[model samples]
Target: MTVLVTGGAGYIGSHMVHALVDSGERVVVLDNLSTGFAWALPAAATLVEGDTGDEVLVSRLIAEHAVEAIVHFAASIVVPDSVADPLGYYRNNTVNSRNVIACAVKGGVKRFVFSSTAAVYGNPDAVPVAEDAPLSPMSPYGSSKLMTEIMLRDAGLAHGLGHVILRYFNVAGADPQARTGQSTRNATHLIKVAVETALGLREKMAVFGTDYPTPDGTCVRDYIHVADLIAAHMDALRHLRGGGASATLNCGYGHGFSVLEVIETVKRVAGVDFPVELAPRRPGDPAAIVASSEKARALLGWQPRFDDLDTIVAHALAWQRKISAEGR
Candidate 1:
């Protein structure tokens, strides 16, 4: 049976595709080229250029490929952009997802893995945020994703849809093989922006808000390598396929790196000291955010391989060099 990956052409989704393909699983990818490119896909999987919300296309693929599972990754991810366009965020992240799930149910897909975000637990008072933390999303993007999580829970109860909701914390790094990375046109993730600045891809990058009561007076985020994070998803898929209960687990290293520390790592690894401006904090940015991934570890028996900050930065830097060389 094939595994269907929505938004499989994008950064995180593409890595998941790689992981699935290497495991000798038949794979089908559905992604609109809005922010995704066909070039990011591995040769082993078949790519279908279409919207996840397209019921006919999604349903047909599930049946045609005998798809047994799905990993939903397509969404509008920018916090500030989601703020400026809440309706657009809700429509794509929520409304479109509804369509995908509806198709999954109709097709009787056995397993589902969702690409949720840490933003759902906005401004939590706890560090190493647990799965049961109070969810107070501070942005439309987060709220929309939270809505989908709720829908999945309700649908599971009503339609017996088994699922694994993975709440990701600041995914970074690239395919260790240097195949793909954060290819977004203008990504604002702290690490990506910092790495690009080190490569002279941009003149400078700002450390958003240095008065957030953090150790270095900057925002702190738990950054997980994309490769390791996808490994967690693979484990989640196995759990679900093996009749494990639906789980909402965090995908993070359970620790964090402040914005300053990350920039320092990039500078140290790239062997270049770039310019950084200390700017006011951006809205919807939590002062410090980590995760309690103990459940993922105990349940999935997953161990991380790329947990070091330097290794993450080095992989990202390599991808940046490729991007610059290819002029992509």
Candidate 2:
């Protein structure tokens, strides 16, 4: 049985693919190459270039590869971009996911691992937001993921499809071996931008929203390393294959760093002080949202290897230097 990983060429998806292939699992990747590069994947994992909304193509891949599981990571995932284009976000994130889930059911796929986001718990009334936090998403990106979660839940209940929904916090860093990392050129992730600025890839970086109700007056996020995030996905796959029940779990380090702190860390890691400007709040951004990942740890037996912010920054800096040198 093979694993069908959607968007397996993207940053986090590529990491998952490397892990899967390292464990000797047969893997097939489906990506549109819109934001994913074909070079990011290992030769062992076959890449089928296409959109997830193409039901005919997806169905064919599922049947052809004899896929028993799907690790979905295809979606548009920028908060402010979602706010600017809600319909686009819905069509890509929600509607395309619906097509994918339907394909999974029709093709007899047994397990599914959804790549979700912590944005679903928009502006939680408390810190360390748990799995049971309120489902009031403030952005279209979050809402689209929530909609997919609903569809997956209903599909599982009605069709016996085992699934796991992992709501991720801010995913950062790269593979420790420099195999793959966040290579998107126009990425809006905070750490990526700060690293770029420190490396002189960008003139300077701005701090979005400094008046938030946090200790340093900046938004706080729980930044989990990409490798750790993939570990959670692997655990979820094992649980599902073992006939465990479907579950929604948060994937994070259970702690957060403010935006300013993250920038400082990037500076310290890169040994450079880039210019920093303060900017107004971006739309659809929450003040602070951390994770309570006890449910995931208890249920999936997940153990995060890289939980320190400075370590995460160092790995990211190394990857940036590599990519910068290679002109990628």
Candidate with top lDDT is: 2
Clashes of each: 1, 0
Question: lDDT per model, in order?
Answer: 0.92, 0.96
In the range 1-328, model 2's lDDT, one tens digit per residue, is 9999999999999999999999999999999999998999999999999999999999999999999999999999999999999999999999999999999999999899999999999999998999998899999999999999999999999998999999999999999999999999979999999999999999989999999999999999999999999999999999999999999999999899999999999988888899999999999999999999999999999999999999999999999999999999
**Where does model 1 exceed 4 Å of error?**
none
After TM-score superposition, the amount by which residue 49's alpha carbon in candidate 2 deviates from its true location, in angstroms, is 0.2
Instruction: Give the CA lDDT, 0 to 100, for residue 314 in model 2.
Output: 94
TM-score of each: 0.98, 0.99
RMSD of every candidate to native, in Å, equals 0.8, 0.5
Candidate 2 least-lDDT 10 residues? 264-273
Candidate 2 lands at a TM-score of 0.99
Candidate 1 TM-score, C-alpha based: 0.98
Off by over 4 Å in 2: none
